[model samples]
Target: MSNRPSPLNDWQRHCVRRTLERGGVIAYPTEAVWGLGCDPWNEDAVMRVLALKQRPLHKGLILVAASVAQVEFLLTPLAPELRQRALAHWPGPVTCLIPDLQQQIPTWVRGRHASIAVRVSEHPVVRDLCNTAGMPLVSTSCNPAGRQPARSGWQVRRYFNDRLDWLVPGELGHERKPSRILDIRTGRRLR
Candidate 1:
């Protein structure tokens, strides 16, 4: 394994940029587990992630960001309370279903639902990746459904290998479980 210490390292960033530019899937560390992601707007890239995990499109996908601003494009007009609620939990492991403003978001992303799942990640690598990519990415646990999520870059490679375009080396944050998913409108936990 390479000894690079940060996601911003030249070689690591190069790998991420190249794979994303080519509309390819990648695996990177998240708060709880490794996550598979790609340019959310790239249908081909999104399809690759779905196929790799044998995930149904109807289940939808999550978008992870460096900041709430990166995903603001997807949110509808919100009440002050709602805005504060979101702001209070962001930059952490909370995924919320917010109103989808741009009806143009592909079904492969929003699935059969009208809202889109989004999170402003606290993990440094994930945050930096979204910043570097200049857009939110389709985020999902780096494993097939019914399986445990990957926790290391090697585990990611072991699960995907040549099937993925790249595996961004990094460490998972200090969480033993996956992120909490909530319905912003209803304030209910989905997962």
Candidate 2:
């Protein structure tokens, strides 16, 4: 294999960040698969991702962050033990479903649910993407509903073609499966 560190370079990363800032949807590598991402706070962008995935609004979406600070806004109302429990698994492949106490998250991101899923990722590209964008991204598998997730940059390109504003070049992290979902309030493992 070539020694290329990742599918993206500094310039490409910058471009992707700009695209996101402009309400563009993008494709990028995640811990277990390629993921479609957009600014979580942008309704139109999030809608595009939902439409692109052919997923229903009630299914909700995931938010991926580079650090706890990036997602701390969603954890503020949780009980200290629950917040601590969720934080203990951070910077890794774990998606925690925390109650949206303030209801500040948009309906598009939360869907019809009272909780929103959030993760603090250790994947270099994912972290870089979130940090560069200055916020967590609405992250979902890079494929239509009921289809296998894209695992490579080529697959992402083929799947979305020119529809995506950018295909962030990167490789999947070591995770062999999507992040496990945990219900923070109930202390239950969802997946």
TM-score of 2: 0.93
Each prediction's whole-model lDDT (CA): 0.85, 0.88
lDDT of 1 by residue, 35-106 (tens): 999999899999999999999999899999988888676653766666666676787899988767557578
Candidate 2 residue spans exceeding 4 A from truth: 1-8
RMSD of each: 3.7, 3.7
**Winning model by TM-score:** 2
Where is the poorest 10-residue window by lDDT in model 2? 1-10
Pairing residues by index, what is the TM-score of model 1? 0.92
lDDT of 1: 0.85
Please state the error at residue 16 of candidate 1 in Å.
Answer: 0.8
Error of 2 at 141 (Å): 0.5
Per-residue accuracy of model 2 over 47-158 as CA lDDT, tens digit each: 9999999999998999999889988888888889989988989978999998899997899999999999999998888888887888888999999888899988877877
